[model samples]
Target: MDANDFVEIDGSYLEGGGQALRNALSLSCILGKPVRVVKIRANRPNPGLSHQHLHGLDLLRDITNADVVGNVLLSTKVEFTPRTILDNTYRVDTRTAASITLIYQMALPVLLFAGRSSRLIVSGGTNVAFAPPVEYMQQVLLPNLKRFGAGFELKVQQYGFYPRGKGTCQLDVQPVAKLNAGQFMDFGRINLVSGVGFCAGRLPVNIAIDMQQTAQREIHRLWPEQECTIETVKHSPEKTRDNGAGILMTANTTGGVVLGASALGKKRIDGHVLGSEASCQLAEYMRKEICVDDYMQDQLIIYMALAVGRSRMRTGRLTKHTRTAIHVAEQMTGVKFDVTVEPGGQTLVTCEGLGQLNKLI
Candidate 1:
């Protein structure tokens, strides 16, 4: 498929969630291919375009100069056509203070494909419910990306959590020609694996400390010599959020992958419960020889699509989100994605022949 082809997506397929919309917008930008999304999140309660989704679309619009129509609250269809490729240094203001990480996810794919070096100043909620907060991106995701030859630094200028969303984060990225495909089947020697939780905005230092202590004890019992820490931040009067915490697990290896699990609840904060839950999730993934988890799978898809040769990874399951991503990829580039599940409940995904796509730039 060329840039001119108009791809169509049926949003009511599975759960009809925001993942469908996000995948479509991301692929549209990456392939410079226009798409029309229909029945968008038809089953969602307050579906279609929430603040985060709108912010994501706005970011894509600014970077790709795309023509977007039928983009409003709860709209069922959207038509997007890119006018140009992404460039450097774009700013997106999610006036509603939705999760900036979601916006970054939508924009990062395009920037990595077309940008030489890019700087982003996103203003919105840094710590929001049901989204990966700045802490997760800084500790878990960014470190894993470094292994693939992508490097970026994030500096939080302010704090924004939940309803009173007013925060800012600056991103600086140095692009790479191609990400190297390497094996992470085994976490070599298990040098370091620890969880850190950060609390901000009306949250007390003891909350952070308790959560850290709980996680440290749990993790040390499972794997001795792992280090853990907690950080607390005071909020401004304008930022009226109760409390927030995010847990990140970093396992260092020759080829390392970080697994993150987070929970953000209002009023009710259980430090030990949160710590144990995050640690248990990481432990489950660590038991597997394959790097298979929801976040890691999605993040690796972009890198695999851009790799020069064949690249493969064993994942937990081929979720609707994963299938939706693969569908959008084929629609945009006419490249088939092959995903297979083995008897051991490991899923293997392989992408080939991206060398030609690399030369197009």
Candidate 2:
């Protein structure tokens, strides 16, 4: 690739986190455009590539057969030039308790574009901080991705929590020629609130049961008209490197809109408090006319921009994550976006997708 042909990205642009690199790498693979990034994660407390970030890049490199430089941990610069897209089952492990869901976020688009069915066995932290939990990926994100016309499935094989990360998940994807644009402007009525409460290792099974009951009690009190169901599961002690517990809540509304919130249990943290906190988060989200939550808002921007039609959604307050994603999308895909700050801290986001089809940009 010629120097002028490569897209130059400032790693410190916008929120300046690993997401900047994640979005850029996924887009580069999709667009088949080379990229040179400088000041990578420059604004983070531990700037540059971490283990999770490196594994994500390496996986992309494997799937795309890309030439990569500066992939070492804590490196501040990198270059990626994708050569081709391959469809095959691949395995990736963070080797520690890094965020596996974050790795999935990067691999999803690449696999979707591989033009053939693909399976991924991802291992790492399933319920780590600063990343969406695996339950959220299975319960919330996968359902919403179906609207984009992409066929994919996620199943958790084990629960991996923070510090000792060894969680595992299987993702199977069917290729599609092009992604259909999805509209999510309507959030009609929330009819069901469902969830999962689970624990691994030495925690008593009753801990999960108590959490589920607490969440059910609160949700029923708040929306008596809505149906609430929670399943409790306990994994064997051998399934995890450490003991952990948590709850994941999903609110499904009309028009295929889904919102999710999750809380991880810690030492000295009460299970009832964790369950109630998750319920409160869901209740607060229900108070707004949102098609998705702030996290989902950021997640959808890339897909919406890649589709061939207009995509519109309503979400909570404008976040730097969303803004950063919008910036990256415009730069990589030539999609135009309109963001309006609505009354009462809500936002309306509209995008005109380029409708890209085929393997070439």
Model 1, TM vs. native: 0.87
Which of the numbered candidates is closest to the native, going by highest lDDT? 2
lDDT of 2 by residue, 158-251 (tens): 8798788889999998877888887877888897899999887878888888889899999889877778999998888666747888999999
lDDT of 2: 0.86
* Model 2, runs deviating above 4 Å: none
Worst 10 residues of 2 by lDDT: 352-361
Off by over 4 Å in 1: 1-4, 178-186, 224-242, 356-361
What TM-score do all the candidates reach, one by one? 0.87, 0.95
